[model samples]
Target chain A: MAKTVTQEFTKGLWEEIAPFRLVLGLCPVLGVTTTMENGIGMGLATTFVLVCSNILVSILRKFIPAKVRIACFIVIIATFVTVVELLMQAFAYPLFLKLGVFIPLIVVNCLVLGRAEAFAFKNKLIPSVADGLGMGVGFTLSLGALGAVREILGTGMFLGMSVFGASYEPFAFMVQAPGAFVCLGLMLCGMNIIGSK
Target chain B: MTELIKMVVVLVLLSSSSGGLLHWLKTQTSSKIEDQQVKFVKGPALKSIFEGSSNDPTADRFTLKVGETEKNFFVGKFDGKTNCVAFEGFGKGGYGGDIGLMIGVDIDNGSVLGAAVTTHSETPGLGAKAKEDPSFVSQLKGLSIESPILVTNDGGKINAMSGATITSRAVCNAANDAGKIYKEIKSQLTEKVKSF
Candidate 1:
């Protein structure tokens, strides 16, 4: 049976997760996600770009030559990234600063290009859009999970809201770069275990 | 020749578009971006000092004036009694970069109330440990005002994180300098009060 648009959308939630399941976009997943909000913001912004870029690339797929497809895709992705960057600065200035260079770096995030080439170029417009949404949500969810663990342990708080009172001690290493790896490693392992079941 | 021209055209189009878009973005977002970065670095520092605390009336800095010297600080009061002066200072040689500390010192007793690392680029597992372990920081509490600053090896007070000597020294010095500056400022203020 042919896959439905909804199936495409749902697949990214688990089976096709950009970082967790697919192992794509590992750099940003492991970086710029010290806080839950930062992770959410980055994930959602990436998703927005993925969805829009996929749709545009798919629509223009036939018009572009195979030899220069990568260049074309990059130009499209970069434009969307600029748009996302500007919008975030205008509306979500604090989150934008927290994201730092990661916002612009999204242009090279492999997941967007991977989808555009593998799925968007071949699939219909609706399926490509769904895939983008699914992947984005999956990425967002994973980042939020990573952020939750880091934030809570790192500063005894969640999303800047204190979960642990003054008496509660925080583990500072959990918020550092090493902590990002530790958390992501354990999470990926957990995801694998659940996926096997 | 047409193909070469087409390639050049594409390249130029791509370059101009990207450059134009980036320039537009910078123009639109530079102010907000600057404001956001300032908030990102300073917001938490402010919260660590003033959140969940009150200002002391007798404190001159509480009125937000430092005279010509132009230093800014916050006063924390508990039950109308001046509890602490949240003072900030920096250390020159931390393991990573300059370590910034916000220290709360008791106004009456002149002892430390608490301390927080407001900024640091210290190595994750090692130097950053200063911000974590309370047992390490508890060494600073109730220590006398004279030479309250120390390293674990020197035995004055304050436990140092193992293998993070530079960071340990930096934070300790920061706390010490903050306390010392507060004392100097407080004495000056008192002299002014006496003269009046």
Candidate 2:
């Protein structure tokens, strides 16, 4: 009845992708996708927290009592989030500044917690690691794609290079908060259409 | 009873280890984080205020104990003479919160050299103009540091930005605070500047 490790890992890439399939962790998805760089930076930070927390949770699952498992999971997650925050501040201060409060807010991202509770807590160590890595890569790709669309349409630039030339007036609306919602909705709709077929 | 004891024991071990690890990490990264803040946030503010100085003010700095906290003062060398210093001050009761101002004073003339906003959360287009637009702060360039700075509405010389009185007042307050610090440490500052 158990799935192979490869199956567990690959599922997160498409079948159970965090943002598109599970529709989770939308706060950062909407907030920091103003630029492609910011989106990628936020994605990598979340990925680090996810993988580390997953490993720790999986290792300790048998020892942690079910009655207080959520609380234990939180402590583990919070520790990793702070580690990500501090490391970013030290090495990538500019990105840290751009991400701002969202870094600390990673502690409450449901995707990290959901994985720990649903998959890591019940799975073997290698499978948990695979699942975490696959999910992380998928999330990074989704955010990068979203960020590219918003940046290009909103500013007529990609990674700060003028893409549409001087005459291409920026749409302006695509970078704003409302634009994030519409962009995400369209992306989700497109995903469903492809999935249905 | 045994199950309850196990839960408590597990929680205690996890919390303590987490706390200990975080404490160690904070200590390791605190200095690096400070360097980043100095480079990104305070560095530009100091550069603008110390414009035309022959030396890099950010690199030539000294710390002095003011009240209970230590404050870093950057020295600007103009014409091969170190006669100016820049430091930061906090203005209370801004529209959003306290505004941070970096004030540069010419010790030789006992007058303000320039001022720049280091950090603030004031409203954009109005209060934010304090940092974005240079005109508001340029007015303080030649004013004597000994006199109290105020907006025109407060029966003083400087004019407040229309629709941003709160933010304007905050900037003025921060200048006044820096002036007060300058006065209190005038001797020590002059002494330190001489070494540069």
lDDT of 2 by residue, B1-196 (tens): 9999999999999999999999999999998998888888888988888888899887788899988899999999989998999999899979999999998999987899999999999999999999999999999999998789998989878899999999999999998998889889889989998999
DockQ of each: 0.22, 0.82
- What DockQ results for candidate 1? 0.22
Give the whole-model CA lDDT for all candidates, comma-separated. 0.76, 0.92
Supply candidate 2's per-residue lDDT for A9: 80
What's the TM for chain B in candidate 2?
0.95
- lDDT of candidate 1 at residue B25, scale 0 to 100: 81
Regions of model 1 farther than 4 Å from truth: A164-167, B1-11, B29-196
Model 1: clashing residue pairs? Answer: none
Question: Highest DockQ, which number?
Answer: 2
- In the order shown, the candidates' Cα RMSDs to the true structure are 8.4, 1.4
Grade the docking of candidate 1: incorrect
Q: Is the docking of candidate 2 incorrect, acceptable, medium or high quality?
A: high
Model 1 iRMSD vs. native: 2.5
